[model samples]
Target: METLANLESFIRSAEHGSFSEAARWLSLTPAAVSRNVAMLERNLGVRLFHRSTRKLTLTEAGESFRLAISDSLSGIQAAIAGIAGDGGEPAGVLKLSLAPTFGVAHILPLLPGFLERYPRIKPEWHFENRQVDLIAEGYDVAIGGGFDLSPTVVARTLAPAHVIAVASPGYMADKTPPREPADLQAFRGIVMRSLQSGRVRHWTMRDVTGREAPVRLQESFVVNDPSAMRGAALLGMGVAMLATADVLADLENGALVRLAPRWYSDAGAISMYFPSRTLLPAKTRAFIDWVVNAFEAEKLAERFAGSLDLRSSRSG
Candidate 1:
């Protein structure tokens, strides 16, 4: 019989395509993971991976074995966890992937209360910009916008990711406010480049009446991150199009004001994602429930909406 440790090492190594990455995920040294995988291959009497200088690729036998045992491994772990007596309490590490800016500014605040309630659930959350393979990377949950909905995962919509133009109070002092999307071309625009495509994003602003107009502005500053663009706008360097959720505090405190209140870019839904499981772990279940409830309690959807006029006249 294959030891669970060896099986786990094999599974993680195959998924990550590298012993180092698998070691990181499993909290084991690379040499330890390699040793376990070697032992597994020895027991099975078949070579599991095609070893190369760069990355590990699963051999035919390895692929077949992985497919046969992946689901069973998950089942065994779940059974063991449930049978272990913390009195059904959610204990152990709960790994999560989160967006850097939004997650830090918003979701992080909820941790103190959550930890107070579920003291045994140790959160290991990574704040990043790129989409992660939740199962492969061993993340318990993810929070972000515009993630591809893979069949293995489930999503819960938290809020609408709506982008709106904003400018610092000082920057607007000498300039006439943009009444419509077209008028934005006259001002210095701080824009974001797409990290995935390596292209400058085009601004297509839509009003409340559903009229779409592309705004071409003189680029004064360009960045790849949303938080940086917001900072530039805050410094009175230029106007920027940013997610409403990101600029809510600035707009509320008069640090920044909306350019065209009715105009917004429909980015997508900000959602929380996790692997689909027949029985979710208590830690994961608790987080989902708490976050969903928190969003509702704070009226995040309404606040994140682009319908509010905090500055100049409405365009339409």
Candidate 2:
């Protein structure tokens, strides 16, 4: 009989298309994943993937097996959730994937209060800078940003906060602040790009007076994450355009300054999305409520006003 270990490894490998990627998804070593696949192959007497230098390709037998068993596995998962309801709340391990920065800046602070409210929902946080496949990875929920989630998932918007154009106090002293969006081309800046969004970070901004039109920026560095780009700006590397929440503490301490607030468009929204289904566990629903309320109770909306406002903490 094929062991569960072998079956799981094969499924992950097929989903990821590489042993290393599958291992990363499972929090295991590539060698361990390879071993599991090998064990499965030995039991079934069939090669699953045709390994080659170019790329891994699923064999005919492998494709058929995936189609047959994937839904069965999902049904098994639903059964587990049903059984875990004996506690009368969310009683299963929840695998949550999120951006590392958002996880730190927002979710971590909110968690203590949330945990105090619900003792039954134990959360396992997975922090990654990359987008994860919820279905393939079996994640219960994920916190995403500026993303249009797949049709299979139900995305819920929690709070939308404006992004601000910001720079360090030191950088502003050396570089004259751009009087308007067009002047951004004259200053050094950073751009944050991700798999989910566009790369027009330095392009333009607007107010009630219609769009300011397109403009180019003198980018000194380009990074894949907002937090990393913000760190570079904090070290006086260059200016950065960031979400209000991401730099709330620094702006409060006068470490960073927002420039010409009128030149910025509304950006940055905190959101939580989950797989679309008829039956959601009570624990999951409780968590969603706890988190949304926490943000509202903390006056997360008010924080945005002063986050990168280039003003003193006293004003906040």
Candidate 3:
């Protein structure tokens, strides 16, 4: 019969990719972990890992087994913790991957209240522009758009990832704003290069009547980060197609003006992602519930949709 010790050893080794690293996590010696995994292999009658002196790699069979048992192991650990009184306080270091601008602007504000409510929980968060592997990286949660989903992950939509062209108010002051998507070809453009792909992304924008057009602008600068692009646009450098959520403050404050209020690109939904459908830790569950409720109460999706012209509303 296979014990949880053997299964845990196999799963931890698969996650860390080494017996030594797995030993560090399991608080056991490397030899002990290796022996446990070997025991598991003998019990299952199949080799799980390709072991070498330098490193360890999961075989195809090992990967399959890891995926199958990873969530179950988490559930078991969580169950044990719950029984051990960890469930009541929701205490732990909750690690999260968040987008640089949006997470700071929107989600970061919610943390104070969350911390107040759950005083035992500690947060360790990183703000970046790339997709992180949730399971392999040991992230409790990741908040972003356009992440590749795995079978062990779950996502909840926060908002529509709407993007539109914007420029500094001073830049648009002396120039005729683009009345149609085709007219943007005449303007100097600040564009974004994909950090993951290292390619400049093109925009396919649609008008109020659902007329879609691919407008290639004259590129003045290309940046990898959205905040940098927003900064450039605010400096009257060039027009930029940016996510509405990212530049909501600028647009509302008249630091930037919309090139075409009706035109936007529906990139995808901004979502909160986390590992596993079952046995989420108390800290993870609390954060998810809190953020979802906040988004709903604030109607963030509608406010950040980029269709409303604040200047027009103020004038009226």
Candidate 4:
């Protein structure tokens, strides 16, 4: 049988990466949390962490324990809430982190309807270009775009971008249009870094064999910001490769043109991600449902191919 105190400590510690962070959340000193975990380990007779100089990693036992405890705690919380009527209405603070462009492009704009629909639920937004771990960073929800996610954290697709190649009319005016992936090698190549790997992901196209064909980089420019890359492409700085949502307006307005040779990129869906809804607070559930509905109602399917620059003039 798991002791309730030990379970609580484990959950809190897992939710916050640092002992100090867990302590702060639990209103206990770091020493106290560490001591509690130590005793719990003694009781179980197992090592939980692989201690090292650089970073903390979980052993197999620790990983299994964490997952078990998460489910157990969720069950307990649901039971308690079942009696307390916490699931009756939406009411609480939802802490969230999101990419800057997403926050501005999708969430922030559509927030008015969500807030109006659920006045009782207040969401605190943290918009940054960095990846936020929901459990480790004390965030209730995180909006992210990537091919995959961490094992410890849970996520749902909110919005994913359709990958596409774009360049400004200003840049393409005098140059020959690229009709193939290798053709980009002759032109100045722009690169964007992946937030997950900290490595630059080459703008790749697909081959008839359904294999990834990488676009050659001529080293024209490199940038981390998708929005800025669009701007650079607009200024004729270089060929900008990004999500279709990043340049839908420019493409439509003739400021930018498609670099489609091999039918290069497709739009990726945006998804709303969180830890778990098994024992979700009413507020969080309500907001999640509302956001999903709003996403559909607003015809957000066209989010990738439309001009988001219209946002400066109108709010969607």
Candidate 5:
């Protein structure tokens, strides 16, 4: 029987297409991961990877073998954890992927309490803007919006991702505020261009009564990041459409005012994602429950929902 270490090395190497990346995720040296994979191949009497300087490509036999064992690996690990008394207390490195600004503003603040409750579990978090492949990247959990849900992953919604027009109070003070989405055309716009597509994003604003209107801003300032756009708006440059969660503090502090308060663009839901498995790691389960409970206690779901914005009640 092949050792679990050797099997794990092979599987991770295959998933990452590089021994160095596999080693990073496995917390092993590249040489160690390579040696274990070589040992596995020797025991199986079949080569699993095409060795190259750039990347390791799976051989036909390797692909077949990976398919056979990939699903079983999680179950085996879970069983081992259970036997090792993991169920009694969660203790391990919990890897997470989170959006940069949102993570720092919201989730990072929760870290103190989370660490207090689960001191044994060390958090390894990456702050990034792009969506990650949770299973292939070996992340314990990911928090973001608009991730394509794969069959192997599960998404639990934390809040509505609603985009609303906003500007610094100074900017809107001298200008007639937008009454609806179409009225937004009158103001100078701070807009975001997609880093991947290089195209300015457009939105359709909707009201509480299910009314929709296309929104096109007069692009006075173009930025690739939401944070930059918010900064520009704060400088009295132009009106910006931003996620409610991103600017909630600014709005509450009266630094920024919502334009067309009754209108918002539905971007989807901010979600916590994890691999779908028969049994999750105790650390992952604990973190998930903790976040869910925190969101509930804070009523963040309602706060992040533009359709449910408190200002909307007083707006025409």
Candidate 6:
């Protein structure tokens, strides 16, 4: 029988396509991972990977072998973990991928409570701006908007991702506020260019009563990140369309003022994503529950509804 370490090393190396990356995830040296994979190939009498200077590519047999044993390996690991007392307490490195600004502003605050509850689960989080490959990158969970849900992954929405036009009070002081979404064309627009498409993004704003209008802002300034756009808007540069959850504090404190508040863009949902629920690790499950519960208790869903009046929503 092949050792579990050998199997794990081979599987991780295959998933990451680089021994160095596999080593980082597995807490082993690249040489160790390479040796383990070589040993596994020798034992099975088949070459699993095409070795090269840059990366590893799965051979035909290797792909077949991986598909055959991947699920089985997960089962075995879970079983071993159960026997080793992991089932009783969630203890492991819970790797997470989170959006930088929103993660810091909203999710980071909950870390203390989470750690207090599950002290044994050490968090290894990466703050990033892009949607991560949950399985390929080996993340336990990811929190953001607009993730492409694969067959192996599941998404639970935490709140609506509503985008609304905003501008600094100083910027708006010199101009008349737009009465409708289309009227925004007259103002200087601080807009975001799509990083994936390399084109300026446009929005169709919808009112509460279902009236939709195309909003065209004068792309006076362009950026690739939301945080930078928000900053520019705050500096009285121009109007920007930003998520309610991202600018909640700014809107609340009167640093930024909403424009055509009745009209907003539905960007999709801010969600928590993880691998399939089958054999889900205790730590991942625990963190998911904690965040969902907190969103409910705090009524963030209502607050994040861009079509609703923030002041009235809070007052009521």
- The best candidate in terms of lDDT: 6
- What TM-score would candidate 4 get against the native? 0.64
Query: What does candidate 1's lDDT look like per residue over 1-316, in tens digits?
Result: 7888899999999999999999999999999999999999998899999999999999999999999999999999998876665566877798999878888888999999999999999999998888999888999899998778789998889998888888898888877888788988898989888988988887798877789999887777889998999899999998898888888888888888888777888888899899985578888999999999999998888888875554343222
Q: lDDT per residue, candidate 2, 1-316, as tens digits?
A: 5666677788889998889888998889999999999888878888889997655679999999888878877787687667776656656577888877767887888788767777766889999866677877888778866656788877777665566677888877856666566766677878765555656455456654665645465677888878888899899877677777778778778888776555665655667877766567776777777777877887766676423343442211
| Candidate 3 residue spans exceeding 4 A from truth | 1-43, 46-87, 307-316
Candidate 6 local lDDT, 248-309, one digit each (tens): 98988988888887889999999999999887888888999999999999999999999787
Write one digit per residue (lDDT tens) for candidate 3, span 82-194. Answer: 65774355889999999989999899999999999999899999998889999999999999988898888999999888888888877877777777778888889999888
In model 1, which residue pairs have backbone atoms overlapping below 3 Å? none
Off by over 4 Å in 1: 1-85, 308-316
TM-score of each: 0.73, 0.65, 0.75, 0.64, 0.74, 0.74
Better of 4 and 5 by lDDT: 5
The stretch of ten residues in a row with the least summed lDDT in candidate 1 is 307-316
Residue 47, candidate 1: alpha-carbon lDDT:
100
lDDT of each: 0.88, 0.73, 0.86, 0.69, 0.90, 0.91
Query: How well does candidate 6 match the true structure, expressed as C-alpha RMSD?
Result: 11.7
| Candidate 5 per-residue lDDT over residues 1-316, each given as its tens digit | 8888999999999989999999999999999999999999998999999999999999999999999998899899998877577545877899999988789888999999899999999999999989999988899999998889888889999999999999887877777777889999998999999999999999999999999999999988898998899889889998899999988888888888888998899999999999975578778899999999999999999998899766532123
Give a tens-digit lDDT track for model 4, residues 192-274.
Answer: 77767888777567644565667766666777787777778778887767776556556556777777434454445566677
Decide which is better by TM-score, 4 or 6.
6
Better of 4 and 6 by lDDT: 6
Model 4 Cα shift for residue 138 (angstroms) = 1.5
Query: Lowest summed lDDT over 10 consecutive residues: which window, candidate 4?
Result: 307-316
Model 2 earns a TM-score of: 0.65
